[model samples]
Target: MIKTRVVVGVDGSAGSAAAVRWAAEEARMRQAELRVLIARHRRESFALDARQADADADTSTVQTAVQQARAVAPGVSVRGVALPGYAVPVLVHAAEEAALVVLGSHGGRSFFGQAHGSVCSQVATQAQCCVVVVRGGEVPADGPIVVGVNDDPDASTIIGRAFEEAAMRGAPLIAVTVRDGGSSTAEEALGTEIDLQLDPWREKYPQVRATREVIGGKPDKVLLQQCRQAQLVVAGARQQGALLGPVGTRLLQRAECPVLIARA
Candidate 1:
């Protein structure tokens, strides 16, 4: 049987539910098993009131989330997971066997945003597998999947994965090139320069209906606007062992829909 293993962390948020649904569809396309994990901290770590509450309540919460995924793809195998401690370590551990991890961005997903739902931020930077961030429920349709390419060769995974996702979702691929508009001279030639980089990707993923759009402006703003109603927005993790900076620190946090941070 084909196996395209995928995992997602749910915290009972609307965004997390969107991520779970997105991953379920992805697993269905890949004919893979879907694992839904919810980090359950030890009761002792919480205040006495919550600590004394029924542990089964937590288990039921996790099971409910798993059911959410199973509802989307009944044929795919589903597992409900609850671990002790913060979401990062628990999710990174799940990534040991997962091909991709899906997450949701809420409140403040940016570097300076509220830290309430930033678990995806930590996992994206450290997970062994790819991490997908979804901010809204809309999936790209009849439109190109936008990818923010960077200088890192590790970005190949993002490119390759975007093709697969676009093909599966029947969305056109739009390879976008954004240069620092901080200076006029750099801005003038950035569009043409990005087209050169998009050429090889077009050839490699030819089967995946795609085109290139070279936009001049800030990377974060351009990407956010492109992802407004997009099926998916993908970017490569920074080469420095962290998925920070524009994509990680900002874009992934603010994009309206799902954003995949594949290894670069």
Candidate 2:
């Protein structure tokens, strides 16, 4: 039976392994199935390459990733599928029915090098649902969940997703607002507006402990500092241009914990 699952991309990279672990844990917490996906491009097709040895190897890689995910979350329902297509389109289609999509910060890269923009970024940007980029960090059992909000309409979507995530993990939610440069009066006013915007979430998720902070600084830097103690950091993506917002891209590169980008 087809079920809603936390879909994760696995390509035998260290980063992909880390993503598998995080996705498995998240699936367990959310009481959802875990689906591990690996995409093989047309050029990598088994019939065309090395008389099926390459296909066998690719299949083994997917199965090994499935095993690792199962090890991470024992008893959680996990399945692996190997698809024939490019990474971006394959993963984006997989997200159609997924509760959320999780990807590693970098995939199939030897060194932990530049990943400011990669397949993960593209998939996250194009996916219809939420996308999580799992980076290096030990998510503490009791760490708070951090979310960055703005004055844009997309902030509502971001904050709502953050509340749901915090409730699922039973962790406190920290709502951070970064202003470029505002006077104390303007800051106070913006803080009040933000609080008003959070009312719906508060009522919907009364069990979640929510706190708000507004300060003048660069959004990316401020959120990175908050990530120092957070289990997860969430940011909003514009509905129009770009798959990921500027701030979300930065956090994916530098966050100590996993970063979730909620599409508006």
Candidate 3:
């Protein structure tokens, strides 16, 4: 059987280092190995020696990140690799064996535009396992864990992961369901469905305080506000050719906390 591991991407940036730290803590919490991956894209304009020099630099960067992660989570399994490929493809492929993939948010021009970096957006959307994009300022250690739930078939999977995280953190879990342009009847129905769906999860995690909120509005707007007081925000993602599901994309773009996208 394949061993479960938490994978993180490093680019020698402060943001990437932060991702390593966050991922290391997560791996330690889950008793999983932490794998740090760094990608060096081929640059045609550079001479052979220059390209080799860049590759060597990336190797050093990966080693430094591994050291940092080890420091943050002592006794946790830490490993690093320097791969030859573009960032998005390499990271997404690595997700195949990863229990979770973590990466930092850095701005760059892409098809998704400037609000989010292309690699972060693409990997989060395409990865088979859960993808976490670390964004926003300092997160409160005492903040609740918020999760978005809708009528989508994958709501149960998303809720399950949220409950696990909340239980591990010893924090409460807030489940938000939105009814857009709907009447009270619709809201009531959704609330009932959400409650029924979360029943088993609540039982499994009896110690985890689970709260449900059924509101009338756009999901993106509601979750964005909820993110302000949340340590992490969880959302479901549907495969859209080259983009994430609409709600997931919006949450990643504007959430005030790290967003976890569970791809379906």
Candidate 4:
């Protein structure tokens, strides 16, 4: 049987290193192959000497990332490659056959800079599979996997992924639904809706201890607060023209832990 592949993009930045570690662990847990990729921009000049130097640097970067990944996951199969192209397109193409695409929250000034907003968002929006943006400090091994729940049709995709992850990591799952009103009736209704969404997944993954919460506040703010104690946050991509909606964008930018954007 062909093993699933997890593709991760890495520069020489600390954030990319963190991504490598996270991706390695995830690949090991999923029993997948880890592909470490480094994208080198093709220079306009095309000077032979400069091109050679760029190739050498790219090779070194990818090799170093591969070593790091192997160190993190000694039993998992890992490979490293340096491709010549822009970061976003290169990763998106790789994601075509990948089970998951993992990236750092920050890619320094060159590629994955969160400040630029174009690279990460574009890849997350365009990738064929789910995208994980590794952010914040070290994830607590004991922390629960938090997932944002709503009435959207894609809620099943998000909750299903969340339960799968929780089962893989042997962690509890917390399903959260945010409401604009503080009325008791609204809270009860929202909680019931979330339970309806989660019941099937709970039965499917009986090992995962799951709970539901209905909070009255902004979606992003409430999720961010929950992220403080979460090892990972799962959110659904918008079903419309856009993929990462406002809540997903904010979590990608400011969440206290890694955010997994479940693709519809």
Candidate 5:
């Protein structure tokens, strides 16, 4: 089992319910514990509802969600939490002790693109571990786990984590590399290099079958395509693109499945 664990944000919404389910399965497959985090709405503290009432409500909802997760993921150790702070800061604090932080793509009531949803965006950008965004599906067996790789120094880490996840879940690893090879000769050169990188992965995790493909066009198109059938898609935060919206402005928001951006 991984030394740390996965913490998922929950807010008693359908999307968060999906997040709870996804995080539970991932933790189960990894033999890691699942932490169901319910960030106490700071503003709620001053609401018409008394502190005891809101706390009780939040705690009860978290308990129910944890029970549901236990039912869905039989053997996974599930834990509940109703934290007393804003979502992002509390999550970042939790991340200080987790291997992965999982969340729903869209928050409990906000669009994924909200400029004010600092918790989700901040956790995605600043978390020290892998941050997974479960966007579209909740069915456990929907599709394969996709990984985006390049010559970036973090590529190997991405490969290892993706392979580990795929192997545990008995899912295929869709290893994808986006190439901006300007011409036919350039394409061949980059494609060969891509092959070399993937070659080592085949031997490293022989049980997890992998397929490599090149996106000769723009980077975003290639990534989006790879994630179309992905149950989980992972990307490394390019040092250069750290300010380019975590996973990238478009890819982060448009991915069809959960997008895990690895940051160590």
Candidate 6:
């Protein structure tokens, strides 16, 4: 049987290092192979000497990241590749056959930058499979897996991923639905809607301890607040647009935990 693959991009930055560690743990949990990739741009001049130097440096960076992954997850199969291209397209192409594509929130001058924020946004929006942006600080080994839910069609997919994550980590699942109204009636109605949505997932993962929360606030704000205590925050990717929806975008930009955008 072919093993599922988890692909991650690194650029020798702290953020990418965090992504490598997080992706390593994720691959270990899922029993998947980890593929670490680095993208490099060749100068138009194409000096053979310069080209060889760039290849050697890029190879070394990927190798360091591979060593980090092996150190973090010894039992998982891991490899590294240094490819020539821009970061966005190379990683997106890698995502075509991957179960997940992991990236850091920041990058170095070579591969990623704050500008790569756009790169992360683009890849998360365009990748064929799920995309995880490792943000904030160290990933918590213990905390509830949090998911944002609504009446949207993608909510089920988002919640399902959350339960799978929680089960894999042996963590509880907190399903949150946010509303702008403070009215008790509105809260109750939204609560019922959330319960109905979570029902099937609850039955599907009986081993996962799950809870429903109806919070009154902006979706992104409420979810950001929850991120403070979450191991991972799962959100839905808007299928029709070039961007993830507002909540997903904000979480990608500012969430206190790694954000997983479910692509369906």
The CA lDDT of each predicted structure is 0.73, 0.82, 0.84, 0.87, 0.75, 0.87
TM-score of each: 0.84, 0.90, 0.91, 0.94, 0.87, 0.94
lDDT of 4 by residue, 1-264 (tens): 343999999877788888899999999989999999988777779899989988898889899999999999999999999998889989999999899999887634756333425667788888989999999388788999999988777889999999999999999999998888777987887788788899999999999999999888889999999999999999877733456889989988899899998975
Alpha carbon lDDT at 157, candidate 1:
68
lDDT of 6 by residue, 47-77 (tens): 8998998889888889999999999999999
Which wins on lDDT, candidate 3 or candidate 4?
A: 4
Q: Best-fitting candidate, measured by TM-score?
A: 4
* Candidate that beats the other on lDDT, 1 or 3, i.e. the better one: 3
Cα lDDT over the full model 4: 0.87
CA lDDT, candidate 3, residue 2: 56
Between candidates 1 and 6, the one scoring higher on lDDT is 6
Evaluate model 5: give its lDDT: 0.75
Steric clash count of candidate 5: 0
RMSD vs true structure, all candidates: 3.9, 3.0, 2.9, 1.9, 3.0, 2.0
**Candidate 3 lDDT, tens digit per residue, 150-218?**
767677888999998899999999999877677788878888888998999999999999999997777
Model 4 misplaced regions, further than 4 Å = 1-3, 112-116, 239-241
Off by over 4 Å in 2: 1-3, 44-51, 107-116, 239-242
By TM-score rank, best first, the candidates go: 4, 6, 3, 2, 5, 1
**What is the C-alpha lDDT profile of model 2 across 1-264, one tens digit per residue?**
445699998777878889899999989888899989887654534365574664677688789989998898997999898877677888889899888999887534421222424776787778988899989557677999999877666778889999999999899999998888978999999899889988899999999999999977888899999998999998876633545767777887889899998864
User: Model 2 Cα displacement at 108 (Å)?
Assistant: 7.1
